[model samples]
Target chain A: MATVEELKLRIRELENELIKSKQKQSDAEHHLRPKIDKMSAEVVDSNPYSRLMALKRMGIVQDYELLLFDYDKVELANMNRLFFQPHQAGLSKVEAAEHTLRNINPDVAFETHNYNITTMDNFTHFMNRISHGGLEEGKPVDLVLSCVDNFEARMAINTACNELGQIWMESGVSENAVSGHIQLIIPGETACFACAPPLVVAANIDEKTLKRDGVCAASLPTTMGVVAGLLVQNVLKYLLGFGTVSYYLGYNAMQDFFPSMAMKANPQCDDRHCRRQQDEYKKKEVERPKQEVVQEEEEVVHEDNEWGIELVSEVSEAELQDASGPVPDLPEGITVAYTIPEKDGASGETVEETDQSLEELMAQMRKM
Target chain B: MATVEELKLRIRELENELIKSKQKQSDAEHHLRPKIDKMSAEVVDSNPYSRLMALKRMGIVQDYELLLFDYDKVELANMNRLFFQPHQAGLSKVEAAEHTLRNINPDVAFETHNYNITTMDNFTHFMNRISHGGLEEGKPVDLVLSCVDNFEARMAINTACNELGQIWMESGVSENAVSGHIQLIIPGETACFACAPPLVVAANIDEKTLKRDGVCAASLPTTMGVVAGLLVQNVLKYLLGFGTVSYYLGYNAMQDFFPSMAMKANPQCDDRHCRRQQDEYKKKEVERPKQEVVQEEEEVVHEDNEWGIELVSEVSEAELQDASGPVPDLPEGITVAYTIPEKDGASGETVEETDQSLEELMAQMRKM
Candidate 1:
């Protein structure tokens, strides 16, 4: 019934209204969550860092800072894992991660590297950053975390960390997506990635040959989330100097089995840098002071016993000795009920003994 | 300098350009990620569900559907954990979660409940939904997961599930933000939440009394993420019937210890519904068909050996017998080296023995 001119005007007005509404929505979102310049432990709904800062209050960690590095762009397929959103597709992974992490905790300064670390030029830059990138310039970073997918990238990190005598952690999820592992690598103290290559590489099999056309590795948010959680937990433990930091931790989702073991650095490691690090570590060990033993003083909770009552142990010393060998010294009121038998062989020695001569192992792998 | 009238006109034009650019940005974002109607395991960059559906291709899960329920709104403080965004602040958590999850997998249908399930009126509705909220109406859901933060909500879920004989998984993180646990609750089969209330509840202490003014419980993304990962992994295993489903799994981040154990249902559970479910389970157990044991047949890899060589184990029968007792039947070419001693007591019996009489435990707790 309306004229074409009038109808055209109405449509244009509707379009303008839609745009205005969209703008208002965006503005409202921004207004609701204003950029915070400082981290506060104040428990409030608006304080994004309150929960995180509570760790300090609870004496879990003294402090935490985050840095990100990646050369890949976010893809829709990555949605199966955590973090990135649909709208983030095509954005550089580092930039996207930084944006999300910044919104979560703006107080922490973030530096992102979007270049590949495998390149010779980038490797130099990476090394330079590791040496100088800290709260205080010229001081090396407290730790490095390697979450790269490929063995090549892992080897590059191993080389850099070994050369710098830096401590780092390596993490990975298996191609099947049901298993993952995180390992702490202290350059000279622990085995570097190169010390024992993965079977795929050690066997002299082309990694590419494992993949087929039109097929890609499966990934699940559950596996990645668990791995990331464990990695961060390990990082917190190492940095805060609390808990026994694991040398190697593995997760198998299928059986819900977590296997952990410590691996000593290989003296015959192929990497020359690793060998140099081992030498330096041996020299430093000699220079280090021996730990002083401190005697623990017992505290008297009740200086006066008005009731004149004393507590007695339920089990006799003879019975206790029968349960195990001579009991170790214990606190006044504490007594041991039982002692678990020692395992057959020391875990560390078993692992070491399992390895054949490096050349022989390599030869066997090559034949496979 | 421009005249006032000309300057005002120029300012208006610049404002128009700004709005136009914002509109364009919004349009581009929407265009880049079009809504997908079905899940596809095509291994392409544009398919959000490709990696998830690959779980099916890899035979991990037949299918996975998600449903969300929450009465709380998203707060900025939640940013410390995974999921949710800054702009999602003030939005209902279920709605926000639904939006995010929908974007990740559009093929799955989602239903969100925004009301508290503890309310009497809502509890009935909740139960009703649970009874008929399957892909096919009038059937129950495959599983229910409880990620609630409070004991009251957990009790509500437990009551509902017990009444319906529905199986569910319960997950929680400790207040200190360093430990967590997940339990699989099969009504009448495993211990229901009410069967043994938490120590605080059993001691008749008001849970609220444990909290201090101005000090909220601490939380960590790591703990929550790990708990969630374990929970969802359990869910997948239970649904897909691959790995053994853990009855109870506890995670202590400080020690990186994962303690697993199974608990039997308490005969004197407080909940009447639980008792009824127990009786029903007992009746069903008797009615269930006995398992059929199928003997495994060995496959002949080399039917024809031209060399006519006979394979013999290196260890003799006497040596093998010395290592352990009589060896169990094994396939040809398999030999036993050493056998691990079985742990002392049945794990289930040990847990049961550790628990004092419920009344005695309760009385002791109350005295504390």
Candidate 2:
């Protein structure tokens, strides 16, 4: 039989659990950490391997898909070796990375160095070197995928991507013009901003978050991992020739701060020959090459600054196969097409997208 | 010549003055709104009326004070009319009576249908009637602050005082803890859990919110209005009230969410009270009065549960008053001679605080 002291202690323990369980109601000032053990049988019985397998077998392991393990139910320490902290049990980074790698195979690993971003270029340079320095010799392939948090970061990323032969994924977080987080470079696939015409930047860019995205003590890992991780996924895919290559992961991290992915087809795949063969083989009426889709659905098919892109629609699959009309004398480098309709004659209507050559765009705006 | 069409198309246009003058390099998502005219200023400008006046009058409103503001600021239009429509804004019995009589001196002519809370029987009857009737008398206060956004707002305020008389203040917002965007209710001191705990016995309870707060949203306006405007101010004063009262004339709403007075103290009156005085006072302190002092200290203290409350060399001037030591035949309140030794003591010595009745203390804990 338990003594009164033991009973009292148990009661106190229960009371503490209750206090923590009712964290939203508790007026005491303390961080609310949910009790991991003794909550429900479902979480208690399952291991991390099952979790990973569930998503993996589903074949839905797209970039930015978030899986939150509610640790409020089971004794985490009991499963820590299997589910979390396999690499390093006690350290915060190692513990975080271990859980992430085991469960989601989170591509981007966040290190909250707590250092100033301005003077903190050394680690960034080192990361760039690691990501870009190809393990092989002369026969370097197309590009590595990358992203950055802001213009300063983007500049750093762009410079690195240029060196590494990579493309950088643009982020809506950067729409707020925050200069903190930066991305690396990827090549071959068109860059996000390079394809889209700055729609998100115009849609967002609220005056309040003009200079910063969130609270002063904001940590980037929890939210932007998908963007960074997606970049990583693209890098691996470009390197390994994976099942399908998604150039743009259309994720709105700010909408809910959950890294969920959506695919954006490239806007510059205007070469009709690329579509004809793929369409015949794939048995689709017409198949726009991945690089030739519209940047954002909202933009008009044609814009004043057309940037050598044509409309995806208005041309039949047969028309694509014809390959007959004299190709419009377009710019020498890159070209894309939009599927969205134009108000006037389809030829003259214009659109603007979130992906901008900011230096050129800013120069044009400044002149205006 | 610039055409009239160009000039006619500008909506809310300002000159280049509206552009950000310099980059603010902080990270927080500092949420706020400003006077539309002040849009040219930084994202968040000062909301303190007292501070503005201090800058204008004396160049600083040097006082430590708590900050309190609701995320949902409502727009109210007021008059002496009764809200004949079920959903309308109007005046209370006293307010209607005053308007009907058109009394010159405020207290000169008054016939009140409202029961005075002076008598216990009357107070109980009043409370029961309101609760049983579901708290809406159809009688109006000065204004009805409705929440436009469906989001349930939360406001927690504390004043460094305990004893609150019958709440008799007009609120820009409503109270009584009804299940709505703006449910105003008095906190602990008046009509606590023992009397009018917020319970949704009569109304269809919102299970989601109930799950969040672990309680049904039931309430009384007597508590609500009392707590809404007047109580909120007191809460701010206590939370951010560094020195004392008696500061300005923005005095009320004229300053627009600014404190009129309560910035400075007689050089002698620090909140914990002068430490030297407390040391001297603790030796001869009594019990009941000490309890009273603890209640006052708590009333003035405002805090959010976001950060932990660290109570340390934390003896308040009031707590020190019960200083008389060694085998003193003390009352039920505080009898033990517990000095938080200027030097160190036992390992498990918790911070010294009020020894109040369990029932009374539990009532206070309900809010927690």
* Top-scoring candidate (DockQ): 1
Residue-by-residue lDDT tens digits, candidate 1, B1-368: 44545545544565576677677657535734655555577878777766665566334443455667789999988877758877788899999898777765555578899999999999999999888987776889989999998787899999999999999999998766777889889898777888766644444445566556556567778789899999988886776554556777778776566766555577778789988988987787676564521111001011121321111212333544532454334321122222222344532111211234434433332332
Looking at model 1, the pairs that clash are: none
Model 1, residue B79: distance off in Å is: 1.3
Return the TM-score for each candidate structure: 0.77, 0.23
lDDT (tens digit, per residue) of candidate 2 on B126-154: 33433333223432121112221121111
Which regions of candidate 1 are displaced past 4 Å?
A1-22, A32-38, A57-65, A292-368, B1-22, B28-38, B57-65, B289-368
- Which residue segments of model 2 deviate by more than 4 Å? A1-47, A54-129, A132-149, A167-170, A174-189, A192-368, B1-368
- State in Å the error of residue B242, model 2: 36
lDDT of 2 at A319: 37
Computed on C-alpha atoms, the DockQ of candidate 2 is: 0.01
List the RMSD of every prediction in angstroms.
11.0, 32.5
